[model samples]
Target chain A: DTAVSQTPKYLVTQMGNDKSIKCEQNLGHDTMYWYKQDSKKFLKIMFSYNNKELIINETVPNRFSPKSPDKAHLNLHINSLELGDSAVYFCASSPQGHYGYTFGSGTRLTVV
Target chain B: SQQGEEDPQALSIQEGENATMNCSYKTSINNLQWYRQNSGRGLVHLILIRSNEREKHSGRLRVTLDTSKKSSSLLITASRAADTASYFCATERQGAQKLVFGQGTRLTINP
Candidate 1:
């Protein structure tokens, strides 16, 4: 079974629309993170939540927001999506304060 | 940007050959991790080396860390075609809980 899984593996939305991506981990992890991979294949941390507590928030756009319903779930919501927002989004998790992270398969989002 | 940077952005090798990728970071680190990502897929954790540890091995993967130099290396021996993927080095800076990922090095193992 996949340790980390994200829903809506493919998303196609229009500009000015709002979209959300859901993520869940089955590894009993305490820390979950949201990462964005740009067209250049560069991945950057957008947000990180440890045990449902906000821990790390990078210089992400205000339009993007991350919500943690519980320790096993972290979802990302983007408002007024723009073409520049088109990229792959990944969700990862790990045991609290651990060095290794298990990543989800990723969601490919396209804004047209 | 406190991020790890991998060198030789890309490498192509034949099957049964060894692949080596190096990463350098700017500050002191708590641990260094290596991840592999196949095309269009998310990253998979390969190994981790702590600051106090000099080297670590798992199966065909070997990881080396030099705290003084703030650098690390990942070696995959007897690489197969399936080994072709982008390798990234992530450094968890001292007192920093999250990882700072490198630009990554793409390796192509031809069979």
Candidate 2:
């Protein structure tokens, strides 16, 4: 079984449109995170959720929001997307006290 | 902001050669991990060296952590063309649930 899985491997939408990306992890980890990798391949943390509770919210724009219904799922919703939002987004999960992470294949978003 | 920074943003070497990358962090950490990412794919966990550990070996990959210097290094020996990918060093803080990542080092193993 895939440890981590994400939907919409590729997304292409015009500016001002809204979209969502879904992620699920079967690792049974308590902590999950979302990361964005820009064109230069610089990976940065965007948000973190622990057992459906928000843990970390970086200095991302207000248009981006993360929702976690349960410990096994976390989804990202982007509103009023712009060209700057064109990047690869990755979902990762790990145990509460463990540093080992399992990352799902990223979703590449392109804002045209 | 990124907690760790990897040196030699990009490197290229012939197959069967050794590739070494260094990472430096600012603050104290409980553990440090290395990850590899191929183009258009998610990152893959490579090795994890705890703060108390000085060195660890996994297959052809060796990771060394120097907590005194707030730094770590990953050495890939006898690298093959399939080893071409970006390498990142991530640091886990004492009490944080999130791991901060560093700007990766793009390694190209030429055939």
Candidate 3:
């Protein structure tokens, strides 16, 4: 079974369009994260939720919001997506106080 | 800006040859981890070394941590063609829940 899974493996949308990416983890982890990987392959943490509580919020724009209904699910909602939003979004989860993370395959988002 | 920086952004070597990548971080960290990502795939955890530990080994993967220099290195022996992937080093800072990743080193194993 896939420990971490993300929906919409590929997404293509136009500018000013809004979309959401869903992520779920069956590892029973306490912390879940959303990361953005740019064309250069530089990964950046966008948001983090531990047990459904917002813990880490980077300097991402307000257009990008992350909601975690529970510790097992974390979803990212982007409003008015811009051209710069074209990149791969990854979902990951780790157990409490653990240093290693299990990541999903990733969703490639392309904004035309 | 506690991100880790990896050296030799890219490396290419023949199969069965050894490959080494270095990572440098700005602040003290609780632990340092190495991950591998194949083309069009997610990152997979490889090995993790704690600040207090100097060296660790997992199969053919060897990792070393130097807290004084705030640097770490990952060495892979007998690299195979399937080992061709981007290697990233992430550091978990003290009192931080997030892991900061490096720019990554693209390793190409030629058959």
Candidate 4:
């Protein structure tokens, strides 16, 4: 079984359009996160939630918002997407205080 | 901002050869982890080394950590073509729960 799963493996939308990506983890982890991998292959953490509570919110733009309905699901909603939003987004989860994370297959977003 | 930076953004080697990747971090860490990502796939956890430990081995993978230098290295022995993937090093801070990742190193294993 896939431990971490993400919906919409690829997404293409026009500028100013809004989109949402869904992520779920079956590993029973307490913490989940969203990371963006740019063209340079730099993966940066955007947000993190533990037990459905926001814990870390990097200096990300206001257009990007993450919502966690429960400890098992974390979703990202992008408002008015821009060309700069084109990148691979990864969802990850880990047990609290654990060392490693289980990442889901990334969602490649393209804003035209 | 990312606290870890990987050296040699890309590497190429023949099959059965060894591949080495290095990562340097800025602050004290509780542990360091190595992850592998194939083309169009998610990151897979490979191995981890604690701050107190100096070296660790898992099958063909060897990891070394130097707390004084705030650096770590991952060595893959007898690498196969299937081992061709991007490698990233992530560090968990001493007290923080989030991990700071480095720009990955792309490794290409030529058959």
lDDT of each: 0.92, 0.94, 0.96, 0.94
Tens-digit per-residue lDDT, B1-111, candidate 1: 748889879999999999999999999888999999999888999998989999999999999999888889999999999999999999888887788899999999988
Model 1: CA > 4 A from native: none
Predictions ranked by DockQ, top down? 3, 4, 1, 2
Cα deviation at B32, candidate 2, in Å, is: 0.6
Q: What is candidate 2's lDDT per residue for A51-88, written digit by digit as tens?
A: 99998999889899999999999999999999999999
Best by lDDT: 3
Over the stretch A1-112, how does candidate 1's per-residue lDDT look in tens digits? Answer: 8589999999999999999999999899999999888888888899999889999999889999999999999999999999999999999998976559999999999999
Candidate 2, residue B65: CA error in Å?
1.0
Lowest summed lDDT across 10 adjacent residues in model 1 chain B is found at B1-10
Error of 3 at A90 (Å): 0.4
State the local distance difference test value for candidate 4. Answer: 0.94
TM-score of each: 0.97, 0.97, 0.99, 0.98
- Model 3: residues with Cα > 4 Å off, grouped in runs: none
User: What is the Cα-based TM-score of model 4?
Assistant: 0.98
1 or 4: which has the higher DockQ?
Answer: 4
Task: List runs of model 4 lying over 4 Å from the truth.
Answer: none
lDDT of 4 by residue, A54-80 (tens): 999999999999999999999999999
RMSD of each: 1.0, 1.0, 0.7, 0.9
- Considering TM-score, which of the candidate structures 1 and 3 is the better prediction for this target? 3
TM-score of chain A, all candidates = 0.96, 0.98, 0.98, 0.98
